[model samples]
Target: MDFPCIDRLEMRQRDLMAGPEPTYEKVVTGYELFHDSTPFVCDHGGVLPQMDVAYESWGRLNADRSNAILIHTGLSGSSHARSHAKNSRPGWWEKFIGPGLAIDTDRFFVVCTNVIGGCYGSTGPWSVNPATGQRYATTFPLLTVNDMVRAQFRLLDHLGIHKLHASVGASMGGMQSLCAAALHPERVGRLVTISACARSHPYSIALRFAQRQALMADPNFRRGFYYDGVQPHVGMKLARAVATVTYRSGPEWELRFGRRRRAPDQPPALCPDFLIETYLDHQSERFCLQYDANSLLYVSKAMDMFDISQSVTRRLAAQREHAAADLGHELATTAAACANVSVCMNIEDQPASTTGHSQAETEDEIAQDLIAGVRNAKQPTLVLGVQSDILFPVKQQREIAEILRRAGNERVTYYELDAMYGHDTFLIDVVNVGAAIKGHLENTT
Candidate 1:
């Protein structure tokens, strides 16, 4: 829809454009490896000679540093998970965190960080490469879920947290939490993943692909090298509006904005005449300039490329190829690969079934591989699913629980919530989501 009445004067004054670097220094407490000499290697062979990680922490670490909980953020979340001394403003997950909240800052030390491929106080495509003295932009290496989780563990190591009390996350954060458990089972004592998937399903991938297309189609995007030029405000706005459709359910939308017209008697125009359209426009406008367009593209692609079963299959193949490889040693190598070093892995770009295997066979093999991957994650786990969620459907949550259980995790606690907010139930329905998390954290058995 054309918004011809947006008041270009007001838009010009607001400068509805994001700069190439992050301006969120106040939101982050400190960096993890700002002065370290060791380089961080990516899954796709990208190297950061000296990386910096922006992170925020709440509460205190015990003397032995055992009462720590690592929280992962969704696709666009920042390091500020809650308000603290440095930043008094409420954070994205403020409702779910704080003293006596679901995360219970009074009893646990909660740490959250912006993923590397992010724009919020973290090194992303917007960051200037020290090697070339230029913004990575479109030249940034491809990222995967494993790469993001590895960065988080590096921060954990910096905090001297050898093991976590629980790894917690929702949405994309859920994928990271699950990866942390499967990839580094010995370091994660417990797991809590909400509204997550074991793999990037085709439906979610297609939705994200469409969002990227909308963003890249803008002339201002300039193929992700829009630095020193006009930012892709139009593209980012349209992409966010498209993503808003997948974040909630049809029933919720119908209930909230059912045939509601901005002006019931006014003639329809190309502009937003309906309440839902206006709502989407407002959301898009608010988000369009707050994030870097390039970072969004990179992070979305990483989410699309995430597949937990691939780790399992790769290990099994290694053991088969080398009879001298021991199970304990292989697990250690996998943990190290997910820590700070690269596994030298590439994105799985081939079709799902190409070895003359039927679709059913491929599906079963992936399931078995996922089960094998999580076999070492025997700690107590909690998985929550929203029935109305179309993005990461309830079936995906069920699959995580089933795989964990089949992998011999007897302490898996699965909950199927009937919230109307769809995939965002964990973020909105705090009462139900918090209760489950609180109970899981408090449960000793």
Candidate 2:
């Protein structure tokens, strides 16, 4: 299908800044790290000579430096989680994070950093490769949730933050929070994960594969080396269109635009005909304007490849029994199904193994580690799930809470929000989302 040309696309930033609501007065200072002497190592054994990570912070670091919160972004989010003194464009989580809001910047120091493999200021496919003098493009090594967490840890160390009072994230960000809590149990005191899972389900992986295929289908993509020429805007638009559908619930679409034609009196044309089609088109266009095509490819793949169980298993081998009886059995069955697909489809480049272990063994170990982490986690954790969410179903959230409870962690709590917004409920349903987070923080304190 023909899509809008990248050159003709008008870039219009969303008007999220204008509001009467109170915002943080502290200057949102921007910071960059990992660009000089430190080289970042990827989970796939690849190394970047130097990497750049862009981040923003608000509020004041107390004398004891204990009132700090780290906010991780989703697949398309940046470091700008909320409005600040400088740029006022409201961030992705502006409603849930402000001076007197859910995060309460007035009393806590909040930091949000763009994930490494993102289109935002952080280093990714668009960044120039120090070795080749050109964009890394497809040459950028594959990344995982753990790799992103490790990068965030460097930022925390740079800021002299030894421990976080709380770590919060939704969607892809939730995966990062899970990784942080599991990998560095002592660094994070409280954890909140919304609409996230321990690992990508096969259905989610299939959806991601379709998006990647859409991008690669464009001849102008040139295998992600389209820096000097026309971009694959059509592919990117199509990919976003697919993702937008998964982000919302079917009930939402039916209630918002039920078979309503864009033009009531006119006949259907080659372009969008229904109101839903128009909505998807608008979302796709907006995404294409703001995000990098290659970055989307990388970030989505990272989400699909994320398996917190693997990271936990690789770290604490002694806690295998906790996982073996519960999560391990389920994970092994899923891995077997995935293996069957891989063999039948002849797709050999599986990104499951973080270490040198075989895929089957690694999957088994991950399940054990996940259970162990939940059992061993001393910090209070809150897992929030949206009832209508299909991408990361409520079942996933329940599984997280159940595993934690099974591991004998009494501090774990799970809440399911009743919202038609589906996976996007955490962003759109601020009242309930904010209340849950604030209540958890208060209880922990």
Candidate 3:
């Protein structure tokens, strides 16, 4: 008797050679945060003297400020989550973020920020180091999902957004959204995680390791300091090509490409004979043009190291019942104060609040609140999984939903999309994704 699971695994192997289409466009933004005095500390014990975070906003902040939604981008995404006056090209999530859409920009003030270690306007390996007056390159500190969330918190603080109606993300962005809720649960009233997990699976780790090796193998890599000269484009392209395979499912490749040749007239002697080969090449070429090799390495490492289970376990171990209650009360009070304030980005140059507490002190309080909130978080959460996704399998999504339900969150919901696009379903199946999100948002609101 042929087992269904065995058949599915075989199909996955067959389509493993195929690659999905690359989709990322440059986002134009006029907002940036410059944090020079206060340093950002990384989990791996690395510190940056100063940092800059680039971001973009959509729609207006409601009077009560209860309609704010924070969107976390995937590994290759920039702060540009949707179209604006300066950017005419569609954003990565343009379909679900506009007016009356899934995210409903007309009713919600949406914010998307480039992660700190991103190659975009954010301070990454491409950014100049104040001490050396050169790009950080290989010297850039290792980052974690929490580190990325911390940087975003700074941006939110600068914008005077103390609470989010919902935190939504897909892929790496999904990872960030989970991190944000886990790290600062009180600040996030709802959570939507799609095609992501609490930690990278071993299979994903191996794939990422292969991609990193390809980049380092390039002679032009020069230990990631190639900005002065030739870049390791070849290796970067190879890495992208490898990654594209995991982003799609085997059944998708079989159905879409079907072992077809690029052209019936093409000679077999020429390279890239299969249609799938050309598709991967196109994806690789597009990615190498827009993304930095080192940024890929840093972000991949961050994803691999993310383990929310460990974080939750540690916080629970350190908590005192009464202290947790006290922290929760303090968080509610401070969050109200933060929500009521209307601070502008220009306030970066101004001194700390005149309320007697230093900026560091205020941040520390917020951090503590976030940790305590995570321990007792009971926010409504929606976990979406793509049925064919290999990178972040449906099992992982189920685990996320299960964890939240077991943690006493009564309103947790789980939805699995039966799409053929695999991990790319979040981007490709906009209608289904939007409908589910809209339904959840409406029910919660």
Candidate 4:
């Protein structure tokens, strides 16, 4: 009668421990990882350690190991990108990756990692900092997209994956995918950089700044170290609310929600009125519940600081990968390059390479150019984008395609469409999206 494995006891425990976070993260079937170094030392003195990574796998890796497809998540997303075949709740990327879906299990072996600084079971401000024997909170060092990619590299190594068919993602995830291909092209055969850019744009920076201010403004926000029970929930919500606006487009919001009020006849207050409003509210609520506030702030900044042309140039100086390399190299080597990229924003009144909320601006173009050195990458690259998406627009996807084409990349393909839901199309319209992805990867010999 006192057996601890009793359903009643376990159910109660689940309710008590689970609020909004992934309570079963420790043993989720598809979600797994290699938890090793958090302090993945970077070029800067800022040491990025103290991390736990959550990951999910789809399909089976081929004996050759080159069939593994890597997926990177955008801001606030974890490794639970799709639902298991029979699972009730649709996985985050169920549309694009599933048994018969786009990134089909029948064909490609897929791997997705919860980036460092992520709160979804991955080490973040919430995880106890080994150095301090307490949650790092604000005490955790600043992180970058490179750190995330590096961590993923180790995970790939742990999994015995020698190469990937393609690496893809949207928004920040898109940024990571790009960085991965750029830095480790040899490790990945095909590169799919969806709604992202070679560098961060000013509009993106402005949007991120608005979101970050919401968190720091909260009195509970303790710089980057508020792990002690007190969390900036309101700030995080506000940030999400703001970001929700950007993740889609004006036309999309109008078409989908279109000012529809909620709960039939109840006046609008703290509750949502329209179906889209309700949808955003649900996502934000779940996000605030599961995702850590500080981790969001830090990761957002990491995306902002993600340019690497200098390092890239040095890496690929011996041989050019393709025109993607030649153009980027020419740009980085030109005076106009600074103006075209690393824009001079007056808001922070700092050099583009030193702006807060502007990881893209601060990005060393050299680091980004490293993609040029890779020779004979075999993965098929597929870049998908929503027409109305403002966050990472179809234009951005085109830029990525151009880069691949310029690289003399024969395995690259691009698709841009009218997913009226805007940036969320990839997440929402998975059937169509996934089907497209599946078709392309499958059709190829």
Candidate 5:
């Protein structure tokens, strides 16, 4: 009895064993775009006929295509994670990247890509829609952390990276990193998420809502259609000022700016009298025009709407639906692969097999859902939380570690930092944060 499926499986094993290992050349060290004409379906109902992802990379991919690390950016950061030959300017994470740094570009092929809805080179509110030949502006589709990761996946496929050695991020970047590994456990080997939560809390959502309100209040905003006119500078400034307040601790601010007047000699005015006020003014002034207002609204909302439990439900349901249509084929394939026991063993690190169980089998418990979301992420995980960060409290980080542990991820490492820098501790307190990251990256076990 000659079984065709078993014969094909044996031939696949022979091809794998006989061939020389494939190798990929290192990516160019500069800004690049991965363009896909295929319609990108959004988590929401919106769709894009064509899209582009702007990215930058450093170091070399090994011959076996391992040792690749993908770094996600904070809410406003771009793809420039580190300085390269093409771009000499220092990046947002300049201190943490490069040779002998926390990320160690010398050992890992590090890459960072601006989120699709960002104001950077990637397609967003600023990009012109091919269908209408006009800018998408506020008309762009609603974005989610999952949508952002899915878009990044397109770029990864283009670069021929089948899997990532690690995915790292802080703040909103942390949210993206967590979502990436949860949604595609097979694609990411290790995970590091700092100052992030499994879901957006009420306080954080309120803060982001206030930022949106400020931006929308400007007459020039014109309901997010201010692209061709004088920008809503006042609104944007106020919004940034509000966001800046949440980025650091009040205790740190007291030490940095205190009650000192901007100018003691000058009589008090209605505006920017205190040093702290002036500091906020400087921060907002520099930011108001740099980023697109609509992008700020979109990305922040995405962060607000993110809930890992909901995401897991959606993913599992989709997988169940897909499996229902091809149960016979799946059984045959599983049988054929079982015939080649060694071949199956060689790929043991692959994603866990999805049972043909109905989606209803998964309970609606939120805690259970959170656990389920990351259940298959058997990688070494690092979760960092800053005690002084009011926006994303340390408890959120604790929850992440607890959930991962409950999910049976034994390699999870949790850190509670007491840095005075608050939510921005990851950016300023590099000595502590760097050491934590360096240790995690080097841990091969």
Candidate 6:
């Protein structure tokens, strides 16, 4: 979509184009992600048979199609990843994905899709279920990272893309990248999973559960059936606040909100508060303003179901527990049938498949390996992250680099960016990060 005089307009105009009108406003020279309708599959096991795939692009696709770089964004991110002919605020990751930047359009074909449950143009919980003609709302499918990846695969298929030069993402996006690798290994030439784990960590699940609870607990949350009228802002904001803490680091919080007290001039001994409180307050408010409660539940639940532990776990407790009077009987059972389960690791992620009890390092190591895959791939991978990143810590990025080194994926490299702006850096530091990504893309090919 060509860049409309978008910067001149506020949040109001963006809503109109991506919201109601069915037209493609130009975003750049030749790149555009037209506003199109996609169907949400409800008739088939609550499947989104058709869904909107909003996107923007640059440069041109070579006839060979080998240059396409498929980008999957994190939770709450849209397809606006760069600036167009006339816009200023640029796009989300516009910093790293344009003309002369890392994901240089001149050299690569880039395509970013709004995930299935995303509020963007994608057909999500808020999307109208073609059957009922009402927003799917709570009726939306219980989607997974694999589902999101499947949706993208279909989009690429629709675009006639049989193979990809690389697939990339951070946080939830990173999770999608890994899922793509696992589910459809041959499709990607290179893969990157930055600051993300193979499966949802228990702590992460707890936090998301809390957020969901906050939203559902609200009188507005009417079960998964809130579409009748009442919306759940208070519940969603409370959940956002819970998530916000995890996105940032404790030390960062100390620096951001630790010094100042609200009652003016209170000393440190007063357990003083700082400006960060106000910052989180405003962020939580704004987040709730744009996102829907049901969307939060769907995405967060998807993350919860991810079993990054899948690829590494070679044995299933159900299979192990079955009284195999005859070994031949095992083939008929399923993994989820087990009562108490423990994953058996392989030599790749662990020294041995020892499973007397769950080892913290075992879990952390598996997650670390996934993150490392992004930084050190035998193929090309671009990693962009914040220095004081409270969300996906710089330490995590460093760990990613180390893991890449260990994995022998030396081709992988990282861009440790400066976004003092904290966890929202990916969303806020678009200009600089976009440039960094663009440069990386240019250097790779």
Q: Which candidate is the best by TM-score?
A: 1
Lowest lDDT block of 10, candidate 1: 348-357
**Candidate 2, superposed: residue stretches over 4 Å from native:** 1-36, 310-369, 373-375
Q: Over the stretch 1-445, how does candidate 3's per-residue lDDT look in tens digits? A: 3354345434533443243311122324454445634655455534565778888889999887888899998887888778788666678888988889998888889999888888778888877776657777777777777788888888888778899999899999998888788778889988999999866778888999999999889777888887766667678878999999999988999998998997778556345668898799788866774787888988987787666754333432243233334334332332321222221111122222121223455644533433443455578889999989989999888877766666667888899999999898998898899999888776744
Superpose all Cα atoms of candidate 5 onto the true structure and report the RMSD in Å to 1 decimal: 17.7
Candidate 5 accuracy as TM-score:
0.83
For model 1, how does the per-residue alpha-carbon lDDT over 1-445 read when each residue is reduced to its tens digit? 5565366524743463533433434334443333333555555554455566778889999999988999999999888888877677788889989889998989999988888889876778887766567776776666677878887888787778999999999999999999999888999988999999988888998999999999999888887777777788788888999899999988998999998999889778677788999899889887887888988898998888777775533643343334223222433342343232223122232113221223556777878878887888898999999999999999999999999999999999999999999988888998999999999987877
Q: Each prediction's Cα RMSD?
A: 5.9, 10.1, 12.8, 11.2, 17.7, 11.1
Ordered from best to worst TM-score, the candidate numbers read 1, 2, 5, 3, 4, 6
Report model 4's TM-score to 2 decimal places.
0.75
Better of 4 and 6 by TM-score: 4
Candidates 3 and 5 compared by lDDT, better number: 5
Model 2 earns a TM-score of 0.83
Candidate 2 residues 300-412, lDDT tens each? 88888776564434532322233233233333342332233221121124334443234666644655666775555667999999999988999888877876676777888
Using TM-score as the yardstick, the better of models 2 and 3 is 2
Alpha-carbon TM-score of each model against the true structure: 0.86, 0.83, 0.80, 0.75, 0.83, 0.68
Q: In terms of TM-score, which candidate is stronger, 3 or 6?
A: 3
Better of 4 and 6 by lDDT: 4
**Candidate 1 Cα RMSD after full superposition onto the native fold (Å):** 5.9
lDDT of 3: 0.74
Off by over 4 Å in 1: 1-36, 310-361
> In model 6, which runs have C-alpha deviations exceeding 4 angstroms?
1-45, 85-89, 262-274, 309-378, 381-445
Q: lDDT: which candidate is best?
A: 5
Per-residue lDDT of model 5, residues 173-262, tens digit only? 999899888878899989999999987878999999999999999877887787666677678888999999999999999999889998
Ordered by lDDT, highest first, the candidates read 5, 1, 2, 3, 4, 6
